[model samples]
Target: MPHRSSTLNRRLVRYAFATLFAALSTQAAWAASFDCGQAKQPDERAICASRQLSEMDVEMAVRYDTLTGLVAMGTRGDMQDEQRAWLHERAACRGDRRCLRASYTKRIDTLKREYDQLKSRGPF
Candidate 1:
């Protein structure tokens, strides 16, 4: 059996790697979806200003992209329209960082769930 200290160390390493993976995915999401230089909305500006919000935005974007690609061709338009509506709702949160963060969190969670559904599908 493994020693307690070694087990603790292994768990810590896994946690660290998970954190690192999340950080990297969020960064890529931000870069892939928006040009920070031209960000105009209050929420966009706020996202650009805060690391947490920016990370959420990126994470959500990545999940959205993945889910969209995974879903059927016939459903693509609906997915995109739903995303647009969500964006409008998110933007309505305006300068409230808490509201914006909550919005991002909910959307990211939803998209992540949808993305996970792809795991059961065969590779095309």
Candidate 2:
């Protein structure tokens, strides 16, 4: 009767929220730093194609951006150079998933170490 209708409405609302959350999570998981629609390079295309690589790209971009913001001007320049070098190295992989994964892993680790060092030196 009325109680059943109320219960059904509550369940419907919960289901809708759950569906929305799941969709957002899935979209976020595949979101990389660069635009997939215009991806031209083989490496870029491969990253766009793979969920795992896309997630790693997002992680690397976030860490790199966060670190760049926190570091001094000179340090930031050096970090940018390092990132450029890493990008070249990653591009050399040219759609090789294993190589791309390894490169991302190494770059992420390096960024993390740098972040930890900055933390140790800072009250800023």
Candidate 3:
């Protein structure tokens, strides 16, 4: 009957929309700061769990790498020590989403500021 066809069309539209939304959400959830395949710690796993945190991780990693290469050999040791301390602080977040978010935000901000200052000094 005509009524049956209408009902089926509506159901198909609903199904399609639901499927599209689900796919988008899943992709966003894993926006991923690092390669999930290489995640080796609870904090790393936590960072991978949320797109925002993952973004923060990616930015931090990039800045850290850039600064390390730009710094002098002697100060590179100090930078390594500072980065290790930050890692310990991040690890203390322990899968707590709020804590991890805060940690990432703070670290990202700190790295950006430090990087800006170093760049302004025109290399040591």
Per-residue lDDT of model 2, residues 1-124, tens digit only = 9999999999999999999789667765586899888899999999999999998999999999999999889999999999999999999999999999999999999999999999999697
lDDT (CA) per prediction: 0.81, 0.94, 0.82
Give me the runs in candidate 3 sitting further than 4 Å from their true place: 1-34
lDDT of 1 by residue, 11-118 (tens): 999999999889677744444258888888888888887778877877888788777877788788888988999999998999899999899888987877766666
Worst window of 10 by summed lDDT in candidate 1: 24-33
Error of 1 at 94 (Å): 0.5
Residue-level lDDT for 105 in candidate 1: 84
Best candidate (score: lDDT): 2
- Alpha carbon lDDT of residue 63, candidate 1? 80
Better of 1 and 3 by TM-score: 1
The number of residue pairs in model 3 that clash at the backbone is 0
How well does candidate 3 match the true structure in TM-score terms?
0.67
Q: Write the per-residue lDDT of candidate 3 for residues 10-108, one digit (tens) a residue.
A: 999999999978966776545564678788888888888777788788788888888889878888898899889998998888888899888878877
